[model samples]
Target: MSLLLLAPALLLVGVVFLWPLLRYAWLSGHAASVLTGLVPLANGGANWQRLLSDGRFWQDTLQTLRFAGVSLSLELLLGLALALLLHQPLRQRGAVRAAVLLPWALPTTVMALGWRWLLNDPYGPLNRLIQGLGGSPYGFLSTPATTWLFTVLADVWKSTPFVALLLLAGLQTIPPELEEALLLEGAGPLQRLWRLTLPLLAPYLLLAALFRLAQALGVFDLIQVLTGGGPASSTESLGLYAYLNGMRFLDFGYSATVMLGMFLLVLLLTSGLLLLRRGWQGTLR
Candidate 1:
């Protein structure tokens, strides 16, 4: 009876996940002939060889790493601060928590559009505020540096609530006695936070970081709507590049190669995260 119930899920996974992944990997290595759609080319390593020699691929990969790294770091820091703030015994804590979730709750497309409007150079509120403050209007999405900054900020705004929620859950799991013990040992508030609280929060912190890392790596809609990988491909991420190739350019063969590369990179990262998580659990035990 259990097997019967599980069969559908297993079938779904095989069909939706395993089959597509296998197809993508196969297509990545082959050339599509005009008549056959895709055929194994005689050039044994041509697809991979091309990928290796493609300067744009490496540049975009670096950009992706930078994007993910900056966004994750900022989100983790902000989320941790927000989580600690919410840990205080305040009136209207529930309302504050609900408000914090608003950005995360909004659809990505909607959030991106809202940000676009807010950051537009000529009439946007942000630039206007800067101008009012007697500073020159900065291009938030026009230049590469500015575009990256907005992308990071956008990601942080939308995702920090998730990290805070996870950290809040972890905070609740901690006993008050542990904090009291630290206080009794003559530890100051900062000491207790750094020494006692943060150490215990390591697992949750790592989990939050991993979650944000995965999401940031595959970020697309926000970047697309915000910058369109533009100001001369300055903000082109792997996801956007793949979309351009597959959808815009209709180059399925090249797109498959890019997708395969991303799949492998994400797989490696996820595997490493799992290993680290397992190690942390072992240490806890």
Candidate 2:
């Protein structure tokens, strides 16, 4: 009876998730052809060989890693700080928490577009303030470095609060008796945070990191809306590259290969993080 009950859910998962993945695995082996959708079932390893040998593909892959690395670091730090602030007893605590979450709650595409306008070169409020202060106007989205910075900023802005909320929940779950005991023992705020609080919150911290890093690795909307991989593909993440190939260029075979590669990379990264989390928990024990 239990097995039968699981059958529908299992079937749903296969239909929705497993089927598409299996199809993509098949598609990844095929090669995109100028003649049609794909070259007929390709000779063994042709797609992987090309993917490995392609300089541009490697660059885009590295770009994706680099972007995620930078964004994740920023978001984690900012989120931790915000969570600590919110964890304090303060007036308007509910209102403040809601305000902090607003950025994360906004639709990503709309938020990216909003950031674009906010940082617009000539007419943006930021540029206006810069000019008011006797600085020359800057085309933020037109330069590789500036565009990357803007994208990172937009992603950080939107994601930090989510990290904060998770950490705040963790913070609330901590036993008050432990903190009071620490205070009675003359532990400073920093000491308590580093020695007691963080040690206890390790699992939740790891969980937040895992979630945030995965999202950062696969983020698409912010890049698409803000930069469009512009300024000579400087901000092109793997996801965006695959999207353009599949949707814009109609190179579904190659796109599927890229997607498969991304999925594998994410799994590898996540596995490593999970291992680290286990090690951390062992250390805590």
Candidate 1 lDDT, tens digit per residue, 1-285?
A: 999999999999999999999987777766754434445554355767888898888888888889999999988899999999999998999999999989999999999999999999968999899999999988888887668888888889999999999999989988999999988889998998888788789989998988888888888999899889888888889999888877877666678888888778778887888888889778777
Enumerate clash totals for all models, in the order shown: 0, 0
Clashing residue pairs for model 2: none
Off by over 4 Å in 2: 32-34, 37-40
TM-score versus the correct structure, for each prediction: 0.90, 0.95
The reply for model 1, stretches above 4 Å from the true place, is 1-9, 32-44, 278-285
Q: After superposition, how far is residue 124 of candidate 1 from its true place, in Å?
A: 0.6
Clashing residue pairs, backbone N/CA/C < 3 A, model 1: none
**TM-score of decoy 2:** 0.95
Give me candidate 1's TM-score against the actual structure: 0.90
Q: For residues 1-285, could you state the per-residue lDDT of candidate 2 as single tens digits?
A: 998999999999999999999998888777665546456556467777878897778888888898898998899899999999999998999999999999999999999999999989899999999999999988999988657878888999999999899999999999999999999999999999999889887877888889988898898999999988888998899999889888888777788888899999889998999999889878877
What overall lDDT goes with each candidate model?
A: 0.86, 0.88
* lDDT, residue 228, candidate 1: 92
